[model samples]
Target: MATHSSEINGPDVNDPAINGPAINGPAIEVDRLTVRRGGRTVLDGIGFSCPPGSITGLLGPSGSGKTTLIRALVGVQIITDGTVTMLGMPAGSAALRSRVGYVTQSPSVYSDLSVAENVRYFAAVFGLGTAEADRAIDDVGLSTAARQVTGSLSGGQRSRVSLACALVARPEVLILDEPTVGQDPLLREDLWDRFHTEAAGGTTVIVSSHVMDEANRCDRLLLLREGTIIADGTPADILSRAGTDSMDEAFLSLIRHSMAGGRSTDEVTS
Candidate 1:
């Protein structure tokens, strides 16, 4: 899927129809959000905005604060300082959680349940009815294996089931953390295509991934290091700034450049 440069910028991110002072503010807005674990600052003063209807990729090396930032957005980890708003509401609020679907790296499926049964179970948990649940299952292309036991399915198939469950409630924002881990390249490509299709149809997707190859598919890339944003722009923009041809090289170049000056990334502190 191809993305236009303009979409990667700040404008036209959220749905103007749902326009409220906050919900229409930005698809995601983080300001000085600091998180600490065991007295160590995992994320410090990180901030960014993801406009509505855009596919924003969170890219960084492991231990660069990607997971911490993700947790902050969903109101999972306690914020030591600052604020996070999703669709204009404060993060972790009931309203916000109700409208945002989250899929984590770990397979959260019921291993013993049939694929269809697993979907049904999640749907019920999220308060979806039979028709809605069935539609969600079909949307993720899990209809064929609907009756297959989840424990017996391949890893890729299990991921599909998890995705279906996430989308079952039709939330306005979908947050995926390393969604394609453990999948082959072909499957990852297919998943990217599916994400593009969904995003174009009006879902705001915030995906955290270390896969540089998939970075180009995102509307915008948020490069993080040690919980700070090193760079935020389209893949081409970052490449241009780093004077590199590939996202992989650009990331390394930028990281070295930022560290040389004693900075983490864009979110780095003095």
Candidate 2:
């Protein structure tokens, strides 16, 4: 766990967050959600809710069910049991088709289309204009590549184009799967800032990433392992729960504690 600590980000104790969101209901709610893949359980009756106007980080090691959990949230994965509701409707409700934005691991853009064309098409699909399309491209740091074809771009650039397409919609709920997997430090920092800005504007943003350092940037976190939740709470809450001030040390302690047969639900609640 300590060696893997290099992959995650830390928290800021002095960072202040706003209060009193206009909408008080949970943006997403999962009740006893379960998923099984390849004759093995991927998510074992896991449940949690993400509040509106907040950034919730879904983090864990490889194969810890992070991708599958996020897939369920976007209504693209089949579940054996449980219910997922977004904005007071079922997970895959028709009403949410335009209200929820999902960015998968693979870039979902037309390879032949230029960045601006790709984003503008999505924007138009959502009844938006060129301003919104341009804003989304800038938000993802792809302004210079606006006229470049996506297929000729590098993998990272293509990923940014996909993100731009999603951002152009400005959906009420945004679900991202490792949005910054191979991005450089400067771009990663810029993208995280964009996420914070989106959350501040009342969008429920859920991001899945392998970077531990980014965990600190989230308002709350859901730590998972082997299809079960190990810990769930704010960064400060998680540190206090693990009896440590360092994020890396705290995760090591919590993982050890969970492996020692004491993964109680009480430890997951705020």
Candidate 3:
């Protein structure tokens, strides 16, 4: 996927007035994070840290607890144990509300409202104005559908509307759960570009996807299987360490090694 660096007309990430001082330390830190649902542990002792101004991909198949981890980071999911720290504060802190933007797997926009109306409503909730709303809509390539009712839009368009709501906040940390599930190849590329642009501007983006191919676009990757982290490292490093050319092959190799009680290649390198 191509990464975009072009300026979008929202809050200037470089402006001190908007971003404040350059943030030090990891944008996200998770230690022994665990979550249980329906008497079963959904996320078991997951640990990782995402550096500031980087794009991290959470790659796994469905039922691998990708969404659960995202919800935990955004302070929505109830965890059974462990801690998630966001930007040096505890996850779900009131102060982090506006600083963290989240887009769920399902669209969260109001179906009765037009796309523009939804953006405006969310912007207001974020204490922002119409200019921010408009910029968000434009950033997601929804300018043409701005006036259409969200319910009348296609699945992909509605998804974009949800994304627009998140972007309007210009959050320092963005967590997206399967944002490109049904998107066409072109739109997927465009969205990845937008993510890269946000990261370039010092935002920490954690995106979850089940697609192994998309893993290549991220700066770092956390491979998960059945609620456990199987590998964590750069795509190139993972490939090299796994002795494979493709992420799919690399993932399988890592899994086999993990099941055989061998340390992950990532562990050896780190």
Every candidate's lDDT: 0.81, 0.86, 0.89
Candidate 3, 47-84: lDDT as tens digits: 99987778999987789899999999999898999999
* Inter-residue clash pairs, candidate 2: 7-212, 8-211, 8-212, 8-213, 9-212, 9-213, 10-213
Q: Worst 10-residue stretch by lDDT in candidate 3? A: 1-10
Alpha-carbon error at 8 in model 1, in Å? 19
Q: Score candidate 3 by TM-score against the native.
A: 0.90
Colliding pairs, model 1: 13-51, 13-52, 14-52, 22-88, 23-87, 229-266, 229-267, 230-265, 230-266
- Predicted candidate 2 versus true structure: per-residue lDDT over 1-270, tens digit per residue: 843452353322122343333444688999999999889999998989987878999888889999999889988889899999998888888889888999988888999999999999999998999999999999888898899999999888898899888888888899999999888888888889989878766788999987878889999999888889889999999988888788888787888888898877535567
lDDT for each residue of candidate 1 in 1-270, tens digit (9 for 90 to 100): 224664574334344543333344578899998998999898888888877678999998999888788888888878899999887788999877668888877778998999888888888888877788789878777788888899998887788789888888887789898989878888788788778767765677899999898899998888888878888888788888889798889899888888888564343221
Candidate 2 local accuracy as lDDT?
0.86
Instruction: Give the TM-scores of the predictions, in the order they appear.
Output: 0.88, 0.88, 0.90
